[model samples]
Target: MNSLVLIAVGLLGILSGWFFYSRFIAARIYQLDAQFRTPAHEFRDGVDFVPTNRYVLWGHHFTSVAGAAPIVGPAIAVIWGWGPAFLWVVLGTIFFAGVHDMGALWASVRNRGQSIGGLSEKLLGSRARWMFMLIMFLVLLMVNAAFATVITNLLIQFPTAVIPVWGAIVVAIGIGQLLYRAQVGLLWPTIIGVGLLYGLILLGNAVPVALPAEIFGLSDRVVWVLLLFLYAGIASTLPVWMLLQPRDYINGIQLFVALGIIYAAALLSAPTVVVPFINDQVPAGTPPIAPLLFVTIACGAISGFHGLVSSGTSSKQLDRETDARLVGYGGAVGEGMLALAAIVCATAGFATLADWQAVYTNFGAGSVGAFVTGGANIVSQGLGIPAGLAATILTVTAALFAGTTMDTGVRLQRYVIQETGAITGIAALKNGTLATLLAIGFCLAIAFGAASDGTGGMVIWPLFGTSNQLLASLTLLMVTVILARLGRPVVFTLVPLVLVLTMAIYALLLQIGTFLGDQNWTLAIMALFILGAAIMVGISAVTALRQTGFSLLAHRHPAE
Candidate 1:
């Protein structure tokens, strides 16, 4: 298990697939027409559907897809040895994720930028539209909860994280004001923003103020959770271009820079890989690859949440059908690369195999966070920075990344609630403000319970993967249904559909067993949620098959 080899394999996987297959081959197979009426044209609006440069759209799409999931997934998957993690990520991105994302984009373009829920209704049924939206709402709630826990922990663990976190917000505000209000172009402001943000980072180090070490007479984790939801309440209601999009752009740049620094460190150190491929010695009842792997590693491979971004926000901004390949397919690959970079940092840059083993053995599966933070410290140390400051900055960056994820999850949840209200004839719930408030309440409740139990850390990893994979499964199902309606080759959609379903079902079963065995009240409640998801998936699949069969029969006969 050579760490460098694993890194090389990951890089090679994305590069070869992106260039040769995704761009050249799959792009053509989709037969995306340049002259087609895109959602930008059909639903032309200033906010969502607007023709824009492909690169800018790529930035938008990439940021929307890249989040804590990628980092967390690879970090946890490394626990099983990088072999399984690397294989799943590389192959999963190439075959399952790339196809699912691109297909969603294509379907949206053809259907005038309708969301996955909308598309499901058109192709599957009106019932499916509601069912899908409900699943999405639950998925997002879990996502928000998990991410909140991760970011909150990081922020508390390292006081230095506040610097980059605040720096990002300040930078976003300046850039957003310039672009939206002042009507200034993005180029100059972006450059200035990055520089100013970096300067602020230095200032933060010079004048570091430790956060009040207590809140609500609870641990820092509890206080952080409360503060995060308070932030989410305000952030989710704001315009995307204001804080979300601009902040994402800044984060995107930071992510790229961090990745470069990490890769450079890995190249310099080239430490041997100590984690074994199959730790047969792992204790029984040690939840390694069963339920944990599926949820823990959600972002890098397949995320149903990506579907929400694809159909919800990204589709509205698509300028052309061809750009879908770049935005959708390319975005997934970018995330996969980010995950690979994390793997390299975790595995290749360790001082020694013994140290890596010690961290894992001592910390158990949760070591991924410390591994990454330590890796960042190693890079900072190599760069001659004081280890304390370096570690602090790294922790803050991770926390900020997690915050972005939580914010996005909250926003998506609001959308889901609104849509659900609309379908359920709940007129009072139709107001965007009310829906948003409801979302905030739900998020806060989950966060509160998670924090109070001190099991917040425990839930984040396992549920993260299951929720995300289920999202992927639903996305694939919707895409398959729509592709079937379009009269495309069913085989193309079938392969990914089956793959997602299989992984999701297997993961869900494992989750059910784990939860039931644990017998904790929270675990039991979550197990019910997992069970419900399994049922929904089963019903959705059966419904899709029946509808496809009926459509085929109708097509074959002139009259029924």
Candidate 2:
């Protein structure tokens, strides 16, 4: 298959989904109102709840939720074949991810920017709400911890990315001041920031920086992880405008440019996909592709993490209730495009079947490495960029994206902790500083405690994938109940809810048995806990639905 085919088809599907499907969702299903008083204005604190431009908010959301998953998940899942991964990426983005993300945003915005977990108290009862928070902690912990390790490893692997990765922070801080404090418009700040960022990338490519093997009596990886958490802790405490919003906006723009180049490379070079549509070579011990594919390709398809980001942060910054469609659903579309890029690159970048087979010796072999290597090959071949520079560009892009997600993940975890404080009557945990420290403590403990190399968090990726889907299903379940109470059509959200819930439950069971067979007691125990909580949530959800069956609440002016 020609690479251009994938590019054209992916773009066509994404554009149609954004133009037609999301509009129908916004107007009919979500019933967004331009005049509705958003929580951003109602609770404008300049910290977490500032009214933002929809484009900037979308940028923040797109990057925060995009993370490394869209690339890693789809890149790895294509081992089952590009056909399955490609179909799931496009179709799931349209039907599953878009709705789940948009509905979570709308639901939270409708309820005063309450997190999905917070909304659970009323929708599913306090017990379910507490359980929702637990799942969130686990998900966010995995994200922050795992992403920190990802960045550190990337820094080690591509030292050329180090300067640009770190320099991007200074640029973000400057951009933040320009937009928020300097009283300037976005145009000049954007031009200067993006120019400076790319300049750093060029400089980084020329002058690569690698740390010594050890620093301060610790390995470079450990030190880098610690520094990353410290940065996240500080970044989380800052106002959104200062770091999160501007940084994400800049990173988002850079990524879009990167996507454009990679897609153009596909058309320009027209590389043939060397891999088969469906692989006959089943890697030993590879799980049955049925449910594992869904979990493996979570974020790009349908992620519970997207729901968390939507409700936790994006809902708080919604400029207008109407912007939810663009920021929420549109963000998912952007991620879908990223995943499509991963699929196209991973399958088409290789020159021959033997080359592809070398990397496919195992199920988990080709992830970030595949995307980066393949993307670099395409860019170098088509765009005439040096191979080394192309690799730096891609690696810097991935590392920066992972960093922003880590920043947001820590802040989201702090919100859960402080919310816990409010619920448990522990005032200190509500303090942002203490809450941040505690969140970091938990993340670091998971990282270093589980693995001495500070890579322990990566072990829970299997749990993270399944539990993330479970949370999405739970979020959709809440949205379904809300629709049932309001007496609107429930088929859209309802169907996806059932599908994701079934897959998640099935996948978790499979993982548990694998863990037991391998004597990996930790994941087995955590997986069981998540499974039990999911069951409890399911029962409570049923009772909640029964209590609100067939009500006739008006959609136009929902009660606050």
Count of backbone collisions within predicted model 2: 0
Q: Write the per-residue lDDT of candidate 1 for residues 394-510, one digit (tens) a residue.
A: 565566667776767777677777767777889878777898789978876666665573435445445656656776777776665655555445555567667666766677677
Clashing pairs in 1: 161-396, 295-465, 295-466, 304-471, 304-472
TM-score per candidate, chains pooled: 0.89, 0.98
Candidate number achieving the greatest lDDT relative to the actual structure: 2
lDDT of 2: 0.91
TM-score of 1: 0.89
lDDT computed for candidate 1 = 0.68
Best by TM-score: 2
lDDT of 2 by residue, 1-560 (tens): 88888889888998899999999988988789999999999999999999998988999999999999999999999899889999999999999999999999999999999999999998888999989899989999999989998899899999999999999999999998988898899899989988999999999999999888888789988888888999999999999999999999999999988998898888789999988888878688777888999899998989999989999999999999999999999999999999999998899989898898899789888999999999999999999989899999999989999999998999999999999999999999999999999999999999999888798889786788899999999999899888877767677898888999999999999999999999999889999999999899889997877766533333433223
